[model samples]
Target: PLQVKRGIIDKQTGKIAGEEEYYVDRDECNRADTTLAGLLKLPPVFDTTSGQGSVTAGNSSQLSDGASATLLMSRERAEALGVRPKLVFRGYAVAGCEPDEMGIGPVFAVPKLLQRHGLRVEDIDLWELNEAFASQVVYCRDRLGLDPEKLNVNGGSISIGHPFGMTGSRLVGTLANEMLRRKARLGVVTMCIGGGQGMAGLFEACL
Candidate 1:
C-alpha cells in the first residue's frame, strides 16, 4: 500500500527500503522467446517439440500498479530523535512450486526456512499465507504444522480482492503491519501461483 501524504520527509535516497519492483514489458518478449529456444537446446521438451525453430515474438501484455512504503530506523536512531518505531524486520525467503501444485509451496518452504534459521515450526508466532485458494492454506496447515488460529488474522484476498502483479508486495505490507499489530516477533507470508509455483517469506518484527 502507498500513501500520498502532506509532510516534509527527511532521509537520503541512498537508503534502500526493502520493497522492489520488477516489471516485464515488450523488450522482454524476444528475450523470453530466445531463452525458451535455448532451453530447448537441451532434451525433453526439445525432443518433443523439435525444430519449432527459433521462437518468434508475439503479442505482449501491459500492466501497471502502485506500491510504496515507510522505512524504520534502528531503535537507537529512532530514540535519539524521541520517536519510537513499532516494528523491525527480520528475514525473507521465496520458494517456487509447480504451477499446477502451486498450493504446496509453503509446505516445502516453511521447513526450509526453519532449518535455515535453526528454528522449529512452533517458533513462528504468526503466518499470513496468501489465500490464492482455500485449499492452499488448508493444505499448508496440515503439512507444515501451522496453527490455523494464527493464520491470516486480518482476512485475505478471498475477502478483499486479488490484484495480480500487486499481490506479492501487498502481502508483504499486510503481513508486516499485522505482525506489528499483534506484537508478534516473527511472521511468514506465502503465496501460490498458477503453473505450480509458489513463494514464502519470513520476517521478524523489530524490537
Candidate 2:
C-alpha cells in the first residue's frame, strides 16, 4: 500500500499545519532495452524456443559498476571503541536447489535458517529478498507468503540496480536502515547464488 499525504499536520495540535506538495518524476533509465525497464521487454531465457534465452536484459539484474563493504567486530571491541552497532549478527544458513530452478534457492535456505534458529516467518519484522530477477522475486515472495508491506519498502534491485558481488552488502545496509526507521527488532537478508545455492543471514536491530 502506497502511503500518500496531502498535507502536513501538527503533531501537538492534530490539525493541518501546512500545505504539502509532491511530484512523480519519470525514471531516467526507463527504456525499451535497459535492464531497469523491468520484465516487459525481456523473455524467459530459460524457457525460450531457441534454448539460448528467455532472460532479457530488462528482466534480469543490470550489470552495474559499484562497490560496498560491511565491517564486523566483536561486541567487546565495538563497545571499547564506543561504536554503536546497528545490528547484531545472529546466524546464517545455506541451501541448494536444482541448477535449472536456481531462483527457488531461497525457498529452501530460509526454512533451514528459521529451523536452525528456532524461529518462524512471523517472528521477522523485515525481509530483504534480493530481486535478482522479477520472475525469481515474484516466485519466492508468493511461496513464502511474505507481507508486501514488510518486504523491500524502498524498492528492490530491479529499481535500484544490482551491483553483483556487492548486492548482499547492499541488502544488509538497506535492511538495517529500514529496520531502524520502522523500529523493528528482527530482519532477514537473503539472496540466491548462481550455482543453485542460496545464502541467508539473521539480524537483530540495535534499539
RMSD of each: 13.6, 12.9
Per-residue lDDT of candidate 1, residues 172-203 (tens digit): 68777777777889877777766666666777
Per-residue lDDT for 172 in model 1? 68
Residues 44-84 of candidate 2 have per-residue lDDT tens digits of 65667875664666666666544678888999999999999
What is the Cα-based lDDT of residue 178 in candidate 1? 78
Shift of residue 199 alpha carbon in model 1, Å: 1.9
lDDT of 2 at 138: 80
Query: What is the Cα-based TM-score of model 1?
Result: 0.57
What range of 10 consecutive residues in model 2 has the weakest lDDT sum? 22-31
* Leading candidate by TM-score: 2
Name the runs in model 1 displaced over 4 angstroms.
1-87
